[model samples]
Target chain A: MQRAKAEFDATGVQILAISTDNLNGPLAMAARDGLEFPILFTALDPSIPQAYGVFNLFGDGLASASVFLIDKQGEIAWKSIGKNYTHQVFPEEIIEQVKKLN
Target chain B: MGAVFGRKNRVLIAISFVAALLLLTVACGDNLSGPSLTSGQQVGAAPSAEAEQPSSAPTPGAATPAAVAAVGSESKSNTPPATATGAESKPDASAAQATGADSKSDTPPPPIATAVSKSDTSSAVAATETATPTGTPVPAPAAVSETPAPTSLPVLVNTPGPVAMLAPDFTLPSIQGPEYTLSEYRGKQPVLVVFYRAYW
Candidate 1:
């Protein structure tokens, strides 16, 4: 999202992030990272994560750390499932791979 | 005691003699069989060459002096004819050319031309047979536009219920310090509703 914002400033590629994280957590993370994109909270809805297949059945019923590259056709082009929440994908690789689809 | 020691020595000598005879036999056998086995292998390998004779014999006739000269001129001319058989025989022509050059032949064969001609012919034939035979001439590919057309925002469908969608209609305090409802902004432009949780 950060790379997209930087590289595609006038290209009109808007980044919309959906999070199942609690209000405070998502807000604090966004603020800390200085995110200019819109991060929407699903109001602790379990169905949202289940629908996206990123739902983890553990404590707090939080969504797993997964990166999905949805193409312009609304098709999932690439997806990565990280075992741990901290094992997130690099933004550069995602941007690079997304550029190929374009 | 002396008789027993002498008897033991005699037995040892006999054993030594037998061992020497066995070694001599083995050595003699190797000398006699080695060359004969090699000759037998040569005889076996001769038929393989004989089998290859017909293929090689036809090639020289097929690659006549006139044909070789034509190929040489084609290679020098830089316009190779396309043919499948010509392509297949290119490597042979190339090798022959190389050998001819090494042997200082008066006329060096055009090896590359022969190969290229063959490839071109085969490729042309294959293309003609398999390619889409549309009656109309193929139009040139469309030029890519520098500026892409503006994409319309996806229409958010409202399910008939009170269920909160991603961009639910709500009256919220705007960044410009005015209370805004989604319905008010509906006619003018697309309103992106972002429901954010406050940390501070």
Candidate 2:
């Protein structure tokens, strides 16, 4: 989220977005949208999203949308899996959650 | 015996024809309507399942977000945030920047892939269905499909562990040169991993 970049960086929180699209698509998105963070390309394999459990329910590649808040020690601190794809984890909410982890 | 065999053969032929027809219909959903739908019809087709996806082929700047991509990055001077946008404009500048930033990244060959195959692959989705006739391009909330009411309800999916459990550690490449490992970032600082469906 380019809009929340300052806040995320201020908190020392790194943001990474992994998509099933090729690195090219993500690269395109980053440049056009002025994304300051990292957006990884998964190619055809859904490893990142699958492990993150975005497709924990139904569908293929990327299914249900989800956010994972993993702590410094790589423990599950908080996770919000949207009921539907459109339900997003807002920046303010994430900012609060990140602060609590500190 | 010959008459009985002929009768059975005719029944099998009829069944085969029906099966072939069904497959053809599903496979040709795009051809059936995609071409006919002028930009005018594409306005409505944007959100329609008939436009479910051109195909799953990975394209640079061509993945469709599950619903909407709201990448309207406003002026956040100190920190640059990547807001999602529904429009999938060509990322000439971004791709160049990406290549410039990361030397380690093996530059992917420019797609000789015609922009036309986009009808076949989900990649190449320029603007989303919500991209208005007015050209303002609104990022509407992504719905699962034409009828999203059913999927809007909660459903079960596998998790490495519950909220308190240790997250599974794995490595994924960063768009930049570095590789992201869950374990590496653990002791240093908090990391949030966001998996977007695709970029529309």
Candidate 3:
């Protein structure tokens, strides 16, 4: 995600990363990795991710690498959920998707 | 007999010290954070073409050139351990193990992360849950929250959700910071929401 930060900024798309980590958890992570983007913690309702169809319902409340490109109208313009955790939706393709919405 | 044994012990200690120092030297020379300068030239666009866009097109996909540097360094610095371990194990096995250790040790953070994730992967069920085309028949974990499972969560997200449809607006708090509303970004610009497992 850091790699695509500039493209996101250029295209006027907001990037919000949600995770199951608690407050201190993501704080420590952000400081350690120098993460510039906002990392929202979803520890309270574990189902926030569930609603998005990214939460692993079968395991502890953990999220998959699910990405959604939301247009200005708040609708999902493009989204992807895959079997491979490491094989993330390519940033280039995301940039293309978001750019298309503009 | 005592004198001979003492001398051998001293020799063994010295050998251990030399080997440890050699290993430290090898480690101190390799920088794991940035790509090797040697790779700077060979990596496409790193030299000149897209230097201005360091983070965009060039940096994220650096795994390739980093792998190249790893290969180059492995071939060169992998000799010492083979020689050291040759005193015990066969040269071939020790050499292989030596290269493996070289690769593992030089890359510390990733190994630690993988070790951690591997150990606690049950928290994620390895992410190959059903409703998808994976082989696992792993039963869904006992649902523990008030949030109801979306009908489209498991098998149905394959189709893109409609455009201009109201997304699930969220009002989640940041780590020790103010709360954010997902819908706030609407009517202004595009918003890309990224949902990941954990920061760890």
Candidate 4:
């Protein structure tokens, strides 16, 4: 994510990450990963995940690993809902799809 | 004497025939004019002239009639101005030069923000002089530009709130070490609050 942000800094794209982890966990993760971008902690907020239609109730009782490509027009251009965290989509594919939007 | 005269005559005739053939070859070559030098020159020169003429020149008359229609279409298409037929005549070198010129034109001179800190001595003297001139009263210099008033950020609307059907506002510490409230940040920038399990 940091590498992607560096490449896209001048392209006027902003990335905001949100995690359901507790405050301490998210802060530690940010510090360890050296993440320069913003990360919002939802404090295990199930409502947020459910609203985005990514909540996996049977799996982890949280949102699945999903990538949503929202275009400049605020429309969802592409979405990939991975079944498991290990099957998460790559960032390059997300970028490729996003580039087509603009 | 008869035999010698006949041999001399044959030799003279052969030499004369050779000389006449050489002269004829030279005359024929000169009159042919080597396949029209002017036409060859025109063929070489035509490409350059065509290149100098803008690619759109042929379509200019048609373009004018649809100028109004094109303006509406162009904004939606995000067509590159560089690809326009009229712009193609510009050589790549000139295009680069034009880009540089455009960048320079668009860039404004640096504001006095940086100079304000370094020239404190000069500013103090100037302030003293101004105070002296207006002995009765003088207003302190106010900032010309306020910290650009925070812009209203976009927020996701029509999404269910934290409460049933009501999007609940929450506060979370920002990665920048400042605590941010979703409702507050929403007024400045759209917030996409994703809730994902870290372990899973």
Best by lDDT: 3
What is the lDDT for A68 in model 2? 78
User: What is the number of residue pairs that collide in model 1?
Assistant: 8
Backbone clashes per model, in order? 8, 27, 1, 10
| TM-score of chain A considered alone, across all candidate predictions | 0.80, 0.85, 0.83, 0.83
Better of 2 and 4 by lDDT: 2
Candidate 3 chain B superposition, TM-score: 0.18
lDDT string, candidate 4, B48-141, tens digits: 3234322423322222112212222222121222132123243233323432343222111111111121122222232233324341121122
- Output the number of the DockQ-best candidate: 3
Q: Scoring only chain A, what TM-score does candidate 3 earn?
A: 0.83
Q: How accurate locally is residue B58 in candidate 1, as Cα lDDT from 0 to 100?
A: 39
Of 1 and 4, the candidate ahead on DockQ is 4
List where candidate 3 sits over 4 angstroms from the true fold. Answer: A22-25, B1-164, B198-200
Clashing pairs in model 1, backbone N/Cα/C closer than 3 A: B81-B117, B82-B120, B82-B121, B83-B117, B83-B118, B83-B121, B86-B118, B87-B118
Q: Per-prediction DockQ, in order?
A: 0.05, 0.28, 0.31, 0.13
TM-score of chain B of 4: 0.17
lDDT of 2: 0.46
Task: Write candidate 4's Cα lDDT for A1-102 as tens digits.
Answer: 556765545444445566755578777877887886678666676665555556663476766666554444343446666566665566676666656655
| Better model by DockQ: candidate 2 vs candidate 4 | 2
Tens-place lDDT digits, model 2, residues A1-102:
678889999999878776665567677787788787776656657655655555544554454556778888778788777676567778889889999988
Error of 4 at B52 (Å): 96
lDDT of 2 by residue, B1-200 (tens): 12222333334433332232222222233433544212223323444532454342223222234221211001111011111111124222233333334222212111111111222122122333223232112112221121232222122112121336566677777777577776778789888877776442
